[model samples]
Target: TSERILGGLSEQGAPVPQGTAAVISDPVKGNVSEADVSGAAGPLPKAPEPAQIEVLTNPSAGQAAATPVQNISTGIVSAVSGATSERLSSAAAEQGAQLTLEVAAVIGDPVRADVTEAQPVGPDSGNGQSPFSLAFLVNLSGLIGGAAIFFLVGGAAERLEARSLRTSRTGLWTVRLLLGLAYALLIAGAELWVAFGLLGVEHEASTAQVYLFLALATTAAASVTMLLAVAFGPAGIGISAVLNVILGLVSSGGLAPLEALPPFYQAYADWLPLRYVIDGLRSLLFYDGSLDAARLEGGWRDSLWFLGGRSEAARLEDAVWMVGAYLVGAATLGYLISLVRDLFARRERPKTGKVAKAAG
Candidate 1:
């Protein structure tokens, strides 16, 4: 007996077998063909009865006059069979023989999705804060005022001592204080010109208010430097640099947030005039120079004058009054020190004369 074989190899190189020979018979067209078969290797086996064999249909071979439904099924089946045959042929060449049946899904409408993208927030978003502006307006102003006063007053102190004209008098101190105030005003004007006129930093305060704020800040810084210089002479410049420039800026929270600083620096920031100046600058730039004392909170860290907490209003008020107090207090203390030194010198001179007369 002969056996039918699908013209292909399995994945594992095994031949595909059909139990008995079959014919592809298109019933409508009456087109019939026998499938390929292989003879038995040795003795002939008994053949199956005709009733056991089944006829497969080749829907693709039907006549053109077939119904539309039949034609569609024919096309689909023909494509699937052609694809399957190619796969089988390749498999047979590579390995042995194979046969498979697969059911395909029906075609449907296409799928789509709507996607959204994200954007980054920038300075224009109202949360903007510039480190450069903070440093320039606060830190730089303090340092510049300290240095300028040191050079101006420190040099004058040295010259006065050299000419034996270092006298403690109210008129002299009044003139010196006036000079410092005038110089501070000039520095404030220059800073404003650079920040607003040149660099174009936006601000909520009027130019006059900003000018007054800057002038007061500079005067406070200069007064401290002047006090050191008048009391300690030229060596006070070094003292001023250490206190106002290095220690002051580090403690002022201008270079970094107060929360990020050490406990000591954070505490120290509350005492420094620079911190008040920085807070005031922030208020002027962002908060429209708001002076509501009700705006108090802890993190501002500008001044410790109030017990409960700090605020933009507290900062602005401190910038004007507290810093102004420092200007007056330091200058007065420097003057008193001068007066004490003069008194000591007068007493020593009288004692020296009495001792010289006794020796003669």
Candidate 2:
């Protein structure tokens, strides 16, 4: 009816039928005319809109566009997870393999480790294998060698006075000792790796144990350095320098046996730490342990006597004695030097007064 009224107005500027109520209905609901309805008829329910039907009919079009993206995300997550799991599995397997290899390595070195029990099968045989001797030699020499070199320098440095030499009153001692110990440990460790890892000669139970041995050896070397410094004072540094030279040249790493050097160096072989260190290293590598049977022989007896005590569990006594000796030696030298300084002071006092009185 509203449309008819609008149509009449557009066509001839005329009004709809006078006093007639206009009825409007949706096309699908069936078109009702004004003649069918009375004036008392209430407004008919509003017709359903076409725009609402169009929206409801195609609600999933946006979802359809997003389907490919959802699928791609799921696929990517699955691929990344699968790759990560595979890599973790492979890494675990590799670590297991390394552990197995290490175990196998420990099992294989019967020749170097079990020297007393393990022997060559054929007719070509050497007699009397000793395991304790081997281990004792290894453990003792590194300690003794480091100590000897440290003190020998002190004994020689009793000659040079610090004032005469154009050098620092006291140099960087802690840094020097630290460096020395570091170098010593470095040499020992590298050689041990070659001996055990490459040559398959020794079996270190763990890296921790090796570290412990290094710490002990470094400590021994440091103690000796302290003793030398105390014994000779500033001159002791010179002693350390000289001793370090000999130790570096002769007893360094696999370069043991000073006798093997030039002919002139042969006498030093017996007393030098190189031979002892080599013997001690062999003991640690080839024998049972540090306090083996072979270490009881010769100068090693003194080392044991000095280090040993009444109880088997007692700590090393030699370290105490050695340090004490270092202190006593230092005190004696200091006393002598003090007297020299006092004498010089006394001599310089009177000559000036006598010269002034004569001139007046």
Candidate 3:
């Protein structure tokens, strides 16, 4: 009996069996080929029987055999999917956080930047000052002083007339004019002292400029008072006091700008002399002196043609002209009223003499 070796090497890469011989079988001729091993030390061993292998086609048995492998593959796929899902969730959270931060940054930027322009000086300028200040008191004092002058002049004229002093009409006119001028000078001087020396009103203009404006304003006020006195006699002092002190101060734009006033008050401000006076004073006190050439040119043209457009400086000049015009117009009106009153007095005198004769 002889032993046969199978094809291929052992685990250590040697031939199959240490002492066995290899056999090759031919299917076509039913013959066996053997390799001799006569030089071996021992007799040959008996050959072993062929292995019996069984094949099964049953579905249950096949599935039972493959169950572990399927389970292992499924576990690997689940682990990969879980890891991918966790990574995706982490990425999504980071993106959401970044987006929230960006949105917050955009929303908070404007508050930090403080985007707003500065307002100009006016009632709505938000300067945080109350309406009643030292400046207001000083202005009110000037009005009271003007009213006192009106009363004093009226009383002096009444006293002169009561004494039967035969003064010519021309002489009386001259005296009234001189008295008005003197009162104007006194008021102007008093206002300068109170505003600058005592109250210390902060102004941008020089002392000379402020004094000039005060003089013009006081002169205008005096002229207005004299006109009323001549036209309505001593009773006109009360009218002058109301016009110059109460109505004038109310519409003067001293407490607020004209634009900020109510519609009714705004309309009244246009006709009030104190409005222009205050406007000119404010321009000289608060406004910068550097003029806009184009604006000045346009304003000059508008003034020449009696048009509406004018800047702050032009408006101040217009105020000076208005004061001058008031002086001229008031003088003419007062002279006419006085002439009419004199003519009426002459006519009444002749009638009174005839009535007395008839009665006797």
Candidate 4:
């Protein structure tokens, strides 16, 4: 926008929004807020006849940015920081539905239409019969199962690795983190395999599932794994492993709905919000969550507090926030536990009594 305004001042002199900006906003066809045109003809003694704008609008950086309706600075997805972000943005822009929301919507869909783009753009994908598929239901069941196993098995290994890495150099800790991430990724891959080959679920992984799960899981798992490594001092990794699996199974709702899960599961589930992270993927895949759907569902309304109001991407934005909370919270808990332990370890020190006396 800064570039558009400044560039307008330089090239077009007093700016008419000659390109796509004027088209989508329909400033001319629609109404431009009078304020934006404050410097128009009235100020210029002989303002050149309002510069004629070309009819066809080219999609450009400037035009893609829609003016915010409220706090939301939409279209920040266009200016992604990395290549992955850029590709996701491009896919969303080109196809309103990404893998998560659009594809996931098809779980239990007998039509198999949701797996592919709808021929006529209906939920059923134009398959006259079997709009809801048994195969889809089976696959959804498999997803929940796979997700459960992914977390449990992956987490268990992570715990062992952390314990092994304790007392090692910082470099070893870094390696532990890397290996932990690998574990998370491997879980996803392994689950996909189970979904396909073992269960014969026939569900193809979507961009949304792969990316969202990997991202959220990796971020949270790394922090939690680190906490286990330092604080448990040996057993942290294994504890984290078990916790990850349980968290994945109960919280994720991959097999069962959140509301349907037993009471104890719900009790622990809230504390383990990784389920929300997982649901985010399902919501994206199955619900085909859009700006409108997001508005209706009230999903991740304010997820971009971390970024400088950049990337208001609904699914991706929500995923980041959920994972970020886990990461920060787990790390904080890790530090607190470590601090408490250090104090307790020194409790028996000869000077400890003197120090306690002095402090008291």
* Residue lDDT tens for model 2, 1-360: 334433434364222222222221121123211213223323325432211111111111112212222232333333333333344334445545332443333223211211121212111111111112222233344345445544554344333434343212123233334544565566557645654566454332344444444444444444444545555655664565456344444433232222224544444343333333333333333332332312222443444465442222212222223323333443345445545645665576588768989999
For all predicted structures, in order, the TM-scores are 0.53, 0.30, 0.53, 0.36
Residues 1-360, candidate 4: write the lDDT tens digits: 334334443453222223434332332232222212212112323322211222222111011111121001111111111222334344445555424443333221212111112122222221211111222222233333333433554466568768863222333334444554555565556654654346443222364454445544554666675666566654665666566654555444444334445666655654454555443433443344321111101223344344333333444445445566766776567556656655665565668768989999
Enumerate residue pairs that collide in model 2.
134-283, 135-283, 137-279, 137-280, 138-280, 138-281, 306-318
Q: Residue-wise lDDT of candidate 1 within 1-360, one digit each (tens)?
A: 011112221222332123211221222122111333233234224321211112133211111111222222333344334433444344444543322222111111111112211212223312223322443454455555655655665467668979967444444455567777887788788887877787676676788988887788777777787677767766776787787678876776544445446778766676666666656766666556773312333443434335434554454665566566677788889679767776787888789889999999
lDDT of 3 by residue, 1-360 (tens): 111112222222222211223121211122112222123233224322222222222111112212222232333333333333344344445555332444333322211111121213333212312112222333444445444654665567678879965334444555565666676666667777866687565556687876776666666666676677666766665687686667666655554434435666666666666665654555555453222211222323354345444554465566566555566676677667667766776778789889999999
Local distance difference test values of all predictions, in order: 0.52, 0.36, 0.47, 0.40
Candidate 3 residue 215 C-alpha distance from true site, Å:
1.2
Model 3 stretches with alpha carbons more than 4 Å out: 1-106, 109-163, 168-173, 233-235, 288-315, 346-360
Candidate order, lDDT descending? 1, 3, 4, 2
Ten contiguous residues with the weakest lDDT in model 3: 24-33
Backbone clashes for every candidate come to 7, 7, 0, 20
